[model samples]
Target: MSCFEILDPAFGRFVLGNAALKQLATGFDWVEGPVWFGDAGCLLFSDIPNDKILRYTPGVGISTYRAPSNYSNGHTRDRQGRLVSCEHGTRRVTRTELDGSITVIADSYQGKSLNSPNDVVVKSDGSIWFTDPHYGIGSNYEGFAADQELPCNVYRIDPDGTIEAVLTDFNCPNGLAFSPDETLLYVADTGRMYQDDPAHIRRFSMESGRPKSLGIFHTIAPGKGDGIRCDMDGNLWSSAGDGVHCIAPDGHLMGKILVPEKVSNICFGGRAKHQLYITATTSLYAITLNRVGAQTP
Candidate 1:
């Protein structure tokens, strides 16, 4: 069967190649939140249902990076090269220091515990941003059942260890990332948790260390996106049920890389930042792309 195709039409000829969709690992409940560590030459992702974080290398396959990971959902590297994670089970954002020690960056705001940290990103200025929804507390599936006392919001943790709310009033915030220039922020509204439709990606202008002038970017699948990243050219790569959709900066659908299972999250890594690692349901996949990823930190 053919897995590659190049379309010729009135617009132009665009090539869609399946150069990498092989499953390197399997037998997980649900996989999400992939991040690339070029220095370590490996990819790390969260398997929420399994309550673990897994690491994958080209030749070594998959290995346990962390267990009882507090049901971490999203991950990214900080400007200082530390691992920043959003913990659903713990209802907080955490970081892993160089010595393998964990630090709670943000857990409670205004003396009340957060709902559930879903996704996270670190700006070039060393500010850690993350999303909080009730996914972790709504049920006992991903995290412990607890009372949600605050509105769903996005927060920024400053270098001095201060947490500031950036945006509030979202049904549920899922995937998120800053543009290559760090001037714009994108977030996926995967509303209605595990349902169809009502799925849209939104964009906000980042100014003076906050988000402003929010708007819609694009929509994905019968479901919404989970994790998101940007390429060097400013194009967005988002996780979708069908595969990974590469959308242009202007919100045009360019093409897709198909996966046998539904994709939950993705990140760019490899020696040249040209590799796209995908976290799909029950498996992990990767491909070498022609473009580099943005240096968020």
Candidate 2:
């Protein structure tokens, strides 16, 4: 049986006919973020419910990278190659230094504690962008339940350590990524989990160093968009209930990669950045593609 549901002819060139989707590992409570460390030849990800960050190597299999990781959810590398992460348990965003020290990036805004930090990304200018949602604090499953001190919002941290709420209108800003040239930013709003809101991704143009909304980019069916990433060609690859949806630059569904379980997040990795690493409900999966991920800066 075919592993893909091709919706448009353009998507055919992006996929490899001989490449088979491979399940890398399983037995996690709930896996979310997946980041590639090319220099170390490993993939690091968050197993949220387990309160651990797991690492997967090409030939070494899965191992514990960091246990009791403060229920971290999403991760990315800064331009300097240091790890930047969102910690649900701590309700903060942190950066892991080369010497193994952890630096708190942002935990509060305007003297009030922020909602749990969800997903994160770093721009070429050394700025850190992330989502603050209540999912982690909504229950005791992923993080400690507590009163939300701040509204769910998207934030940006300047290289000088100034914190600002870039977008304030999202019900729940989940995953986000920048376009190839960093001219456009795509953010997923998975507010349907709490109310009768739309489950879609919004596109915004960078104007005056802030995001100017371009309106709803695309809405996901079957399930809401949980995480999203962009390819070098400006295609947005988003996570869905059934699998991963590849949307073209023009806001059209290009194709779908069928997964047996729900996908929470994904990242382009491997030697040439041609391997798409996926973090599903209970397992980690990957498939080779004919595309490369957008380089940082």
Q: Name the top TM-score candidate.
A: 2
Judged by whole-model lDDT over C-alpha atoms, candidate 2 comes out at 0.93
Best candidate, lDDT:
2
**Candidate 1 lDDT tens digits, 1-297:** 533222223112222255546687899988888888878878889999789999988788889999989998899999788899999888989999999999999999999899999999888898888999788898888888888888788888999999988788678888889998899999887874555547788999987878885688988764467788988778888888778777778887777777778888888887888777888888888777767888642
Off by over 4 Å in 2: none
Give per-residue CA lDDT, model 2, range 1-297, as digits (tens).
Answer: 778889999899999999999999988889999999999999999999999999999998999999989999999999989999999999999999999999999999999998899999998889999999899989999999989888899999999999999999999999999998899999999992458887799999998789999999999878989889999999999999999999999999999999999999999999999999999999999999998998542
Query: In model 1, where do residues sit more than 4 Å from their true spots?
Result: 1-18, 194-197
- What would the TM-scores of all predictions be? 0.92, 0.98
- lDDT of each structure? 0.82, 0.93
TM-score of 1: 0.92
Query: What is the Cα-based lDDT of residue 17 in candidate 2?
Result: 91
Worst 10 residues of 1 by lDDT: 5-14
Worst lDDT window (10 residues) for model 2?
191-200
